[model samples]
Target: MKRALLGADDLFPTGGEAPPWPGRLVELDGSRLLVRDTPATAPGAEPALYVHGLGGSSTNWTDLAGLLAGRLEGQAIDLPGFGRSEPARRYTIAAFADRVIRWIEHSGRGPVHLFGNSLGGAISVRVAGLRPDLVRTLTLVSPALPFLDPRRSSQSRALPLLAIPRGDRLATRLLTRVTPEQMADQIIDSCFADPRRVSEMRRLEAVEEIRIRYELAHYIPAYLSSLRGLVSCFLRAYLPGAGSLWRIASRITAPTLVIGGRQDQLVDIRVAPQAARVIPDSRLLILDGVGHVAQMEVPRVVARAAVAMLDEVSRPDAERPPRPSRAVRVGVAAAKPGSAQVAPA
Candidate 1:
């Protein structure tokens, strides 16, 4: 396989606080969001919107967004309660999806390529199902969908705490006692396949980021609410017919790409193919050594796959080849959204 070609911009930031990358705040009718916009180097490139995972900000997409800048005009959003965005008055998966849809609709950038990771991935799926006309294609990386073993996930472990009376406050107080650097280290251990791979500079940056977020009075509430929303979504996804994510995935008309990390401790990698099976026009990619945040860990590879998927879907039906069945497509390595090859476990 050919290595993915990448520029310096496709790399993670090394310096602290603000990096050299360009970003701005986008204000909608009811809310404001921080967006990292990367304009295409050439004219008339397709527009793409990226969503981050639970507890993550738009910064999660910084590397991947930059990598895809040449092929797509991309915007990485910090969902409400994460990053710089304020907490939503009512936090729910539907509410979050609605806000994203509103932003795209107001910006008149409908039918854009939609990419999401973790919670954002689930939100992107919701958007694709609700407003197919607004989504050109869908790409999900470690989407926070329901998994068989909830105990394997950190989010699941925290669910019990939320059930307690005044739980959110108690959790906040406990979190405050922990320093940002310690929290950053814990995150690295949980999210990465190899924690030592993170550089000292990057660690410092993460520490600073956590420090700022920890200082915010709304931070804990936002995190707690988002957690509840995701848990609620997972419960809803298990319902029979119509209401399930399976139903939503089947309804998506846009071509789709699903990415998973083999060593993902949060969302099980085994579920990747199951996710791809529901999307009529979709393929799955599982990275051997990677964990939860594939786009962050392997930005160039994910970007290359994304570009290829987009190109394949862009072709007219008469010109395009017959798509492979979901089972076959799930089996193939680096499978095209429409190809049929058995994926290796």
Candidate 2:
């Protein structure tokens, strides 16, 4: 694979660019998924797939995908019922992973770079573990791996609602009170260390997306069920078993990059290092002052780290540098003092 050198100017889309990438519905195994395609700028660029977190869509990857477009022909999928995709009968992590695997197979893009955020991260872990042949590199941004501490983040506070009967309905009623604009603001506030980092245009786009999704009959159910499924997975992770995500992470064969935001409120930043430790060939990056969504919060930094990993993997084994004995922390200057720390080796 040829590597494309990205200058500082290439890290973001130019001003006055159009909206997010165009998307179309793709049918694979009788299921339709909405996929947004970002064409690569460099010749011979390899394929890459992006998966969004719960309550997010393919648009979540716009900035990061655009930043890496020179080295990767990126396709970001709106997992079942999230964006424009059709709902699935099951919303389990395994089900979501299967959809991703099937898409890679159907598109003949196997062994491609795989990217995921939050819920998508867990799904990507399963895909990289179960279908190692289909993933060349795995990049997880604040992956929602099973964390024992639910109180660490405000988002986890909603987990109990999933246990209550008709919690989806309750959620729907609560959400109905808030306008799409308010909802969008709330999401931005929760996901970003500084909500002001989000451009006004992006905020409008998010509100528009929420407005459209609110009309979808399956949207709320899909979101709630997926959350319940995630919580279930977390519980299962506690049991000593081979089926756990940690075990699966240990089995991943692809070169992995685990990116975490120091101020992430969804998935605890503390779990980031542990995730890197489990993967046999993995590098860890924790960005200071970043929140749950590092890709959106700091696309340039994320792209730099991602491109570096790609370059490293493209090199011949003899020429590649040795793996770090401990996580080599980077991008900390972008945050506050002592906000992030390297996990002990």
Candidate 3:
């Protein structure tokens, strides 16, 4: 057998050591959230927070956080009900946004640079719009804005809350008996391009996730109720994101970066222009051949883009509210309004 670069024995450095950083629990609106802080690894490091999307835990940002910590004090939180955090009483976008806001306040890092991906991106956008004072700048990746192209398939992307089997009784029954592997497989597949490529270590991690979900299954009814409320309140109507994104985006006062991938199956790149147009100070960047997972697909590019957005405003000579993001390439004509074509971004 070949020597693995990162062998099991090298899993973590051990000198009977304290973790380089410690994770703490914060109370946000009655919900306990898992938060970890990476102190200034450099002479002077700015503060930043990484928010994960629905069905994702803070682990999603672990690799990126490590890289970012080199330049800034890094923080990432497991939103209520995801990761190590307990589920929130209500799991709506607003609810999640409120949780994030509270976490920021709890961290005592005022006006921190906040980066979010997918659903996290959407919530970050909303929070920045309503509470710009708390946010120094915003970075969004393949944000899950409501681009309801009715023609596309929803085979892979399933919001665990929304994916709860319909009807309370059936869902309760299934939740009580379902295996963690079953839940983890569906959850992992939804985020990755190919489940076969999910890597062995991640597979092991999924085992723990499954165990957690199983333990929490007793709250299936509550999750279902929250799921319904979220879909009804935010996902419906002529408005988007429970119909708040456009309004929120239009009012965003902080400098912003809107990024997406050309091949994002869930969120079309076409949405980037509208995001640019709405966020008074936002710039758009569209990466090529990437899926919805831009951070995972191209972390360096996304991080560089985020740093640029921050420096765009942070630099003394830099101006405010940069010209709308120039990276948006109009998507191909597939889901043209009223046309039956399935648009490909």
Candidate 4:
């Protein structure tokens, strides 16, 4: 596959020229979801759906979606209880996937280029697996899948603990003690390899977002519930044949891109290669010095890679012949080096 190169300016666009993120509340399954529809610069581009990570809103895709505007008509959704959306009736991954499926079916916009991060990744996996007709392609960034690695940070360790009776209350109290700016700082520290690299404008935006999220009456409850749901997903020891994420991945025929950040503190980097291996028509891209949120932290890098994948698959099947049943590794990092191979257990 050909590698796409993006200019430095593409990564850091000037103010005002940044792509527009127009917000709309779309109802799916009787629940309102805040979505950002970014029109493509080119006419009649295919539709793409972006799902943000846990606690992330549609705004998280602002930069990355803009960069892909030339090739895709992008829409980023605020999952139930996040951003401007209301709390969901249920908080399971299946529940979240069902809402997305309903929206796509109702809108007659099936088989879109689907992109997801963290918790959204797991949700997208279920969608692509169960409703393969709804996903044209799949892109996952630092997906929070189950793994047996013991080298986890406190943030991850705290997730399963939220299931305890008083866990949510204790966590809420600790979070409430911090100012919004401090909360933003904490998030940046955990999600970015270099928090200082975040532009001043972006920093201000994040601080304001933190403030708004903190003010939401249902925010903490929703966050805790989602975290608990994710923990349950991780704990399920499904057999290899059925009801497993790897099994779900194998059923997906869509061309897939599994992206991982070398410095990601949440999801283990090794999961990327494993996902690529399981998904038949998949490729892996590991970005150096990036963290959990590659779309937000390194939009240009991710945009180029995504566009490259689209370009490869867009060609005639005759010209772009399918390879053997093995997954491909499509990218390498310059800032830091790590094994891109799927390591054995």
**Best TM-score goes to which candidate?**
2
lDDT of 4 by residue, 1-345 (tens): 112223344533333325339899987767788888998888878999998878888887887887788888988888898989889867878788887788778777778999989888888988999988899999998887767664764366565557678776776788789987777777777887766556656666777877887778788878888877777676663544466676787788888888888888878888877777777778777777777888877677778778867877888888875545533333333322111100000
lDDT against the true structure, per candidate, is 0.73, 0.82, 0.61, 0.74
Stretches off by above 4 angstroms in model 2 are 1-18, 331-345
Q: Which of the two candidates, 1 or 3, achieves a greater TM-score against the reference?
A: 1
Residue-level lDDT of model 1, residues 1-345, one tens digit each, is 111122243333332222415667778776677777877777778899988888888777766676676778988777887788867886777788998998899878888999988888888988999899999999999888777578767657777776888777898889878888778878877786666555565667677878888778887787778788777777778887576776787789888888888878888776677778777778777777677887766665677678777666677878865654433211213422211100000
Report the C-alpha displacement of residue 120, candidate 4, in angstroms: 1.0
Q: How many clashing residue pairs appear in each of the predictions shown?
A: 7, 1, 7, 1
Per-residue lDDT tens digits of candidate 2, residues 1-345? 122122354554554434689999988788788999999998999999999999888888887888788889999999898989999999999999999998999899888999999999999999999999999999999999998788877777677678889887888888899998888878877888876676677777887888997899899899988988888898898899887999999999898889888888888787888888888888888777788887887777788888888888789999976654666554434442221111100
**Model 3 TM-score on a 0 to 1 scale:** 0.75
Candidate 1 segments whose C-alpha is farther than 4 A from its true place: 1-20, 321-345
lDDT of 4: 0.74
TM-score of 2: 0.91
Q: Report the candidate with higher lDDT, 1 versus 4.
A: 4
TM-score of each: 0.86, 0.91, 0.75, 0.87
Candidate 4 Cα misplacement greater than 4 A, ranges = 1-20, 237-241, 321-345
Candidate 1 Cα RMSD after full superposition onto the native fold (Å)? 6.7
